[model samples]
Target: MSTSIKQTASSTTNPTTTPAAMPVKTVVITGASSGFGRLACKAFQKAGWNVAATMRSPERENELNTLRNVQLFPLDVCDRQSIESTITSVMETFGRIDCLINNAGYGAFGFLEEASEEEIMQQMNTNFLGVINTTQAVLPYMRKQKEGSIINVTSLAGLMGMPMLSLYSASKFAVEGLTESLSHELAEFGIRVHLIEPGAFKTGFSSAYSFNEGQATPELNRERGVYKKFLDNMLAEPPKPFGYGDPQDVASLMLKIAQTPKSPLRNVIGKDGKSLMLTQKLLGKKRLLKVIGNAAMPKLSA
Candidate 1:
């Protein structure tokens, strides 16, 4: 199921010997059913790259399937064996994976103390460990090619923690660290490690966030009540730039990062996200914490 890259007209005497154009680069994007992943598939395809738009359920994909140079594959980042299988299929189909987008992660929202052990572990496994597993599986191919890029879609939560997103933040923070360390380690192999720290995007993530349903126990329920107001207040506030953002922006940023030769290891995706990160760097830890805490939960002053 290989998707053919778009070609331009050529006027060489010997087409076989002269090479019509640069070899088509293939990108393997996890979680391509929706959000940034979906848009990135279109963006890459528009840029003349063959896109392996891998999702957990390819049957549900409608948009990317209509596009040229995009093939949908079944992939689950949390499942190591499945990841390996998907990569193998992609390699067999396309012959190379020039870019690997680790974008198959979800958010787990709620008080950390109230979340069940299962919830916590699932969040970590899907978000942090999933990236680790997928990257490990793809590194062999990327290494063999000796020229590939691994772009991780982290979040603003990875940069700064906020109320009720403890587990989500923790998982993203872990990815941020992993990307940083791997950048140093994989640099020699020409494998550029990049992390996309997206801000509040108008995606289904909020509605799709996994909640701690197991926290209904009397003791945990009472504990949840204690933190409910803070969490609620934080959740109620409208996101910067007038609520959620368009996923296309993040997709564009990802395309830009992939095209750039010396892109930064950590790339923030939105205006607000960049502002928040810049302020944190200038304000230092204590001051930044104070600012973010106050902003996240405005009722804290009361």
Candidate 2:
């Protein structure tokens, strides 16, 4: 089941002993079926790196499968066995994993009160625990290599909470903290752990948005009515002030972070993301909250 591709040197001398035959660096990206993950697979491959694109259903994928140095593997981050097996398979195929991108997560929109127990658990497990599982599975290989990078795709929500994304924000916030702490812990091992916080983008994530459908109890229904406008606005297209970004930009940044040895621990991508983070840094929390409040719910803010 190995999909390893070895490069051959063209020199008359022995190819095995030639410098040109050095093994290509490989990156394992989860959620590579579409969005940033898919683009990253292409970016790394185009840059002459081996790519192990792992999705929940590799059988359903067609694009990356057609690429030269890219291989697809079935991976479900929520399942520990799947993560371990996928990592093992990737290691066997690529022979070396220089980078790992934990990017397989979905958004859970709606008010916190409207979120059912199952919805909450799924959000936490997929966004937070999934990162942990995948990271743990890849750490041993990266540690042995003694020089690797781990780029985690968190969101702008991780930086600041917004309306209708309470659970999603919480999950991302958890990853933000985990990544920061893990970066410090893994610094000595030569494994650089970084976080990429992207703002709204025109990606499959918008279409894959998961709106929490809690039980239709009388109280919950009434609550939904009160928050309907805010929820709708949040679900709608990004406001004029904060338009969606190009997904390729995020993918490019991922590739850069993987290649750079001293990349920052946290990278905020997209114009909107950078602006919001800048505002928070300069204007303080109170002003930042007002800006977010006005954007998310003008009527409620007024």
Candidate 3:
């Protein structure tokens, strides 16, 4: 079941009143219940663009429902049916989709050997395949319009692999590769593809994180203690300095990317993200790996 609520004309100017030459733009955002997705909805709506904020459960949401020109629709990127239904509903409500933001994903943290098959599949399905599903569902509509943008919210982990977040990083890396390729493939149709790689931000992402420890086998269980300690140290003090920034900055970047035609293909946002990317570029892979190893497990490296 899907629910969409829009503010009345009293709260917002009627779209019909706008000059026919300049129609209002519309954006569809996934994972709109919290974090960057939620903020992006507000940013776009504030910019006078219609916002279709899609999430898994729209009935439970209260905040976005009151905003002008912002509607909530139930959408699960892992489920193709939900994606199709939500896109259809958004088109019905707003008439056109000028941008699509694939921000629906979660993190699964654990060593690769300890991760269960279910965990691996779930991580890949939601983080990687989910983006693919949502992007595919919207392509036809954007193609018909002959001009649109798809902005994918990936992580800095996508660029540099984090030990405990191997699966999560892999999923994001897949998105990075996919979006880079699609930029070229979709250019002819006037559709632009972009990637927003953000570092740690003050959001619910950490709270939503899933950890895998019980999935380790009896033999691997003994070794899990060592891995757990390494994970703990990494979390307490990461190798690369990352300071959490306001998630709204990421939301604003998404809006900028959507509105700017000649925007760069991949944008690395946040102070920590920029610093880490620059470090990697200067030090190269081998030196960066050694630095990460020393920082993550100083005693062991020593």
Candidate 4:
């Protein structure tokens, strides 16, 4: 993909330049094409912050132009050269970026045994490596200014285990660990970072996930397919906790964290996610293991 940085100077003044010393809080977001990324870009733009919404394909970007304060930058996080160049262009146009949201990622779903090596790497490279590259690119500016925020988007799978989602879980688990460690290390430099762990919201992520091999593993597929009836019956009790979370609900929470004076190191995004975490905390090792084990797939009888 060809990358282009269309830079336009704002008649709007930078607070950093003034004696009043208003912080020039610009943000650079990766994966601005869709999902939470798209919603976040608009939300920040509406809040009157200078936004650089970087997508893989900028030529096809007419939607972002409609927004008043967002600049569209063509950035593919997987390409190191592209990431570097995009960072340069962002620096040139905006002067300094106060926040870098590493939001570009796709889910890899289905049974692990059927997933290929290539599929796993694709998910990891984009989900985990992309965050690393973007954070490294922004570190210089944030360090020079000695203040910034890096927000990493993880998932409920990042915290808890689930059936048929091992690869996806691994990728998010990596993000959880990465952000948890970096939050402490970067605090000393006047740079603050955060992680957002969202639950299953209807961003179409589940449907969009890459299945191991859509047609492979016929037995597993058939078992799950017919057993869908069993699970549906199991769920038909007095109903569980809350239902699917709205994406805007999580997005609003993320915005609050972004705008707060000092955001927490980790912002858990859904009621269900928060509930699960509470249970894990209260239950501790033994009970949690039993709960996870019961839901896990049964071993084949040898």
Best by lDDT: 2
Off by over 4 Å in 1: 1-20, 213-237, 240-242, 298-302
Mark the regions of model 2 whose C-alpha exceeds 4 Å error after superposition: 1-21, 222-238, 298-302
Tens digits of per-residue lDDT, candidate 1, 248-298, equal: 988888888888979999888777787777787798868987887766653
Error of 2 at 59 (Å): 0.9
TM-score winner among the candidates? 2
All candidates' TM-scores?
Answer: 0.87, 0.89, 0.87, 0.82
- Candidate 4 wrong stretches, greater than 4 Å: 1-18, 21-23, 214-240, 285-302
Q: For candidate 3, write residues 1-302 as lDDT tens digits.
A: 11222333335567455333478999999999999999999999999999999999999999999999999999988888988988899989989999999998999987688788888988998999999998998899999999999999899889878766789999999999999999999999999999999887878775688887547778765456676666666455433555578899999999999999999999999888787778889999778867766665435322
lDDT of 2 by residue, 1-302 (tens): 12232333443357566444467999999989999999999999999999999998999987899999999999999899999998999989989999999999999977676678999999999999999999999899889988899999999899888777899999999999999999999989999999999988988676687878774467556556656655666557664676889999999999999999989999999898888878889999788988787767535323
TM-score of 2: 0.89
Arrange candidates, best TM-score first.
2, 3, 1, 4
lDDT string for model 4 (40-155, tens) is: 88888888888899999988987987888789999988888899999999999989988889989987756677677788788889999998999999999999998888889998
For model 3, give the 10-residue run with minimal summed lDDT.
1-10
Winner by lDDT between candidate 2 and candidate 1:
2
Clashing pairs in 3: none
For model 3, the superposed segments whose C-alpha errors exceed 4 Å read 1-19, 226-242, 297-302
